[model samples]
Target: MRKKYLFIGLFIFAILFTFGCTSGNNPKDSFQKYVDAWEKQDYKTMYTFLSPSSKKSISEKDFIAKYTNIYNGIEVNKISVAPDYPKSFKKDSDGNTSIPFKVTMSTVAGNIKFNDTAYFSNNTKDSSNPWSLNWNIKMIYPDLNTDDKIRIDKTFGKRGEIKDANGSYLAQNSYIESVGIVPEKLGADAENSKKQIADILKIDKGVIDKALSASYVLPDMFIQIDNLSMDDTDRLSSLAKIPGVMLKKTPARVYPLKEKAALLTGYVQPISADELKKLSSQGYSKDDSIGKSGLEKIYEKQLKATDGAEIYITDKEGKKLKTIVKKTEQNGKDINLTIDSNIQSALYDQYKVDSGTAVAMNPKTGAVLALVSAPGYDPNDFVLGMSKDKWNSLQNDPNKPLLNRFQATFAPGSSFKPITAAIGLKTGKLDPNADKNISGLKWQKDSSWGNYYVTRDAAYNSPANLLNALVYSDNIYFAKTALDIGKDNFINETKKFGIGKTLPFEYGLDASKISPDNSIKDDIGLADSGYGQGQVLMNPVQLVSIYTSFVNNGNIIAPYLNAAKGTPGKILESNVFSQDISNTILNDLTQVVSNPAGTGYGAYMPNLPLAGKTGTAEIKKSQTDTTGTENGWFIATNTNNPKLLVLEMYENVKNKGGSHYVVPNVKSIFEQFCK
Candidate 1:
């Protein structure tokens, strides 16, 4: 009986010993679990693996603080942990095992690679003596002591220049001197400095006084006075002599073309707080500049540069001990636009009217040569930070200088006659060669078509065919043609031309509406729309696109601004009109400019054979203005080289003589390019 009891006791003791040895020998498994926790930022789970002595030295809260505060400051984006030496754990004579590890951390600053060791030992609290990690700050980052920290420094890349087709600078960075006053540094001369600055810049004295009266004015801080031009170096030298005045040169976005190409080039401004929050993950900082409109806003991602960064290991005193990672910033790629600088300048000069828009494109390839919106404001104003008063003045201007007229809609008037003529021919509703006994003065569907009457000039009183009607721009002729085509076919044919749809353009465009919801309402309404009236609105860009079909033998190609030599034009519609039909329409349009009695005869070039149309749209009086106005429009193409198409529209020509107001400008633009 004694021998049996002794045997059972020895057997149980042997089993307990076996379990303790197995748990203590598996240090690699314990180290792997701890590494997994660290990678996930689960400090609590990591802390559970710490040996009894390690936990006593550093609490879980302190362990988490090390990762969240110090590590996060470096902008760590990713962390990867792997065995540094061998997969097996190394045992020391002290009954402890060490698992070597290689940690690579990817951060905004750069990649930081380092070696660390996680020590494991049998826990004193466990009777089984299970292996546990002897954790410490050193296990995460090598040589990371309580008084040491990680520091990161960022360097922004330089913005690229915007150049025209000829490589002339449109938008570029320039150095300007910012003059300001340091009030506290002025001592007894604060009042004198303010007066001197105001006098030198010819600015109001109250402006300087208000700037100095700020509650948070600091002695060493700068209070901006003005941004001095580079040409104002002499003035800057004189201003710097003021007691408390300081002048610092800083880089600024500048439009070398100024107001000439302002509408197309656009401008940039400091990013708002909301923008920063949304773009934070893209590495956008508070001080970054962002594009606000036009081409600048459209290609922001391509124009934006890649930011570089540097990471430093530093002591508590803020002295950088060594740089862990360094990266060089890559400058942004320069953008080359398709606009011809000379043609653009000529177009702007010829648009002498106060408010209007014009667009010229290659009819064959659809490459836009020039685009202009009159009453343009200098983009430099926005870039240099426009004052509240100046901004309000521009916003309130009657001409709407900030509006991009090229994208804004206008009643096409008789300029839309060609489209109406096309619809009539396509639907077999009108005979191009046969003469119609249409009234020149007035016409209506019938007596029951209400009191609505389509009136025309008495000059069109003679028997008229398609050719003669187009030359005279007889409103009655086109209106009669639209009614004959019927409402459903008219709407469907117009839709085929992409009317009432938003044009696909890189620079945004407002959709042209035939009429809201394509509704013609009644026979009179349909007739009114025939001559580009009754809710029919078209933008200059789309108008040029529609005209290109006549030039390209009735194959409509959507106009594009940024086409290279071999880039094929996108075909919007095929077989819009047969070759014979397109030729007949082209011949009739040519007579409008070539014929002596044609309305567009004034737009004829001396040597260039021009083909085009003219229009005059009436505007109704509105609450904003008591006087109604007329919008003059003209579109033409060179008869020899049909690829060159020009479109011009003049606004608010109340008493102006019909389409005659736009003829000279259109002629001048063609002369510049064709001659």
Candidate 2:
């Protein structure tokens, strides 16, 4: 019995000894530990599993650096190292095992995938690690070797062009004649020549001083001062005569319409530092240009294409080795606008001295035909590096050339009377033919009103009804109509016309409002708002949309900017006015332009029958304030065709014939286009 127990214990000890030997000598186990460390990027732990000869060939620090440099240089991500080993241990003649593996990583250029084998041997001197990997530079990449190079080749995409309705290039990539300065060529007259250059360029002296102060500026290097328009042959000639002022042709973003379309097309400048950091991963660099405002800004992503690159490995002899990743460049898309260049140029021509905004639309389809803001700066000035003085001049101009006025709102004045009349007729609060029997240039509703009174021209105080009131722009007549509609009903119905709501346009517009907070506080406030005064303000685009309802059988059409999105009969407000009610207001608006006594009669043409209204919005602290200014407005379209509808407003038209100042402008546009 003693011999049997001792034999059983010896058998159990033999089984345990065999298990320890297999676990310590397993190549699969050692390879797993090395790969696990590799996955975690723990190079120190990976170094511990390297063979004695491999460790002597490269230091741990150098091994870690080589991996980090390659990974960072290619902007690598999703690094995967998958090992495929044989089910049974197979040793070669040298007593080493080979483990095949696959590596895949996503990089900026594209994806990189390769397969390689890792050789592990049990010839290590360390007792703790019997199995060790034989490391070399090829382990980093299959095609990699000492003195090989990894390089990135960048391919830039072309920026998109912006075109108008007639296929005219509003904004394009074209070259312009540029004037520059060679500091060393100035000779003894450097200061005089700089002054002459500034004078010819219309730039400030400080701009020249700043350019000269650049650290990289050399006496012989040509520093660009400004670009000249093709029409500026005289200025180019003037610049050529100046010493040290060299003329060169360079690539630029050219705006053919110049100041006529500056506010609409906008411009681009160099990518800012903040922009670069935010967009670095998307392939944006400091050399790129970004849109600053207008439609260029609204469609920046569509206009700016992604830059492509190819990352490759090369030997010391500059020979092609292997392409790690390759990406194809994509050019930007061309944006086609619905704007008519003829109408845009004509409208801008009328505003040489005044500050105003004009919006022309196709009343039937809601296509925006033209958007013009007067006193506009040349958009090309921005692309060619505008001088400090030139920039400051635009900023300091009182006319506020930088302000996008079409997106802004202003008092609609008496031009709002037609809208009020329509609303009144819809609510059954107004009778078109019935006389109000009020006789006065100014009147108020009872003694409850402190000192406010709704006034009209002294010549329009008889038989106050809707038709006669609109013809003469009788403010008191419409004021009474609004009070009858009541505050809550008026505000609610007005909001139905898209008032107090953001316009559904790609280009952002300030929402039109009934009042400051979309409410009328008192009868006086309500009365003033009735005539498009008080807190009432309307964007020119919104007003054109509202006016479109009159010509569209009582449905306000949705305004659109993109030419491809032209959907005729796309209604923004459905049935805001009944057909009969809309007809009545339309007939009255016609008489407002046709009748001799009408305020808008100045807009009447010989053969073209037009219908419209005129508004002179008073900007003052109180009704009695004589120091107030007026904004002149005229909204007109041909009743015969109902195709082209235009609304124009000029600021501070106090003495310039009031609303009549804008009458001829619209009339001329209709005479030219409506024919």
Best candidate, TM-score-wise? 2
Q: Model 1, which residues run further than 4 Å from truth?
A: 1-150, 182-189, 199-223, 229-244, 315-320, 324-327, 563-570, 621-627
Model 2 whole-model lDDT (C-alpha atoms): 0.87
Which whole-number lDDT from 0 to 100 does residue 113 have in model 1?
90
Error of 2 at 634 (Å): 0.2
Query: What are the Cα lDDT values of the candidates?
Result: 0.81, 0.87
lDDT of 2 by residue, 1-675 (tens): 999999999998999897766766568888888888887777789898899889999998988887778776776644678999787677899888899999877666777888999998886566788888988888888788888978878887878889998899988878888788898898797898888888887778888989988999999998887778766798899888888988888666788998898889989888887987677666665557888888788888888866688898899997879888899888788899989999999999999899999999999899999999888988988887776777899999998999988989999899899889988998989998989987867899988786767888755545778899999888888899999999988998998899999999878999999877898998998999999999999999999999998988899999998877667669999999888887888888999899999988988886998889999999998888999999999999899878999999999999888999999999999999999
Candidate 1 lDDT, 1-675, residue by residue in tens:
999999999999999897755545567667777778778877788788888888899888987887777567766656779965455556789877877788887666667899877778866567543778787666756766667887778888888778876888888878777888877777686777777788898788999888878898876888897887766777888987888888888898888777678899899899887997677567665567888887777778877766788877789999988787887777777777767777777878776546888888888777777889997998887865677888999999998889999978998899999999999998999988777787547777789956667878665555678999899888888888898899999999998888888888777887887887877898887998998987899988988988989878888877765434225577777778877778888899999998988989998766898999999987875313457788999899998966678898888776778788889888887877786
Candidate 2: Cα lDDT at 406: 92
Model 1 local distance difference test score: 0.81
Model 1 root-mean-square deviation: 7.3
How high is each candidate's TM-score? 0.78, 0.79
Error of 1 at 367 (Å): 0.8
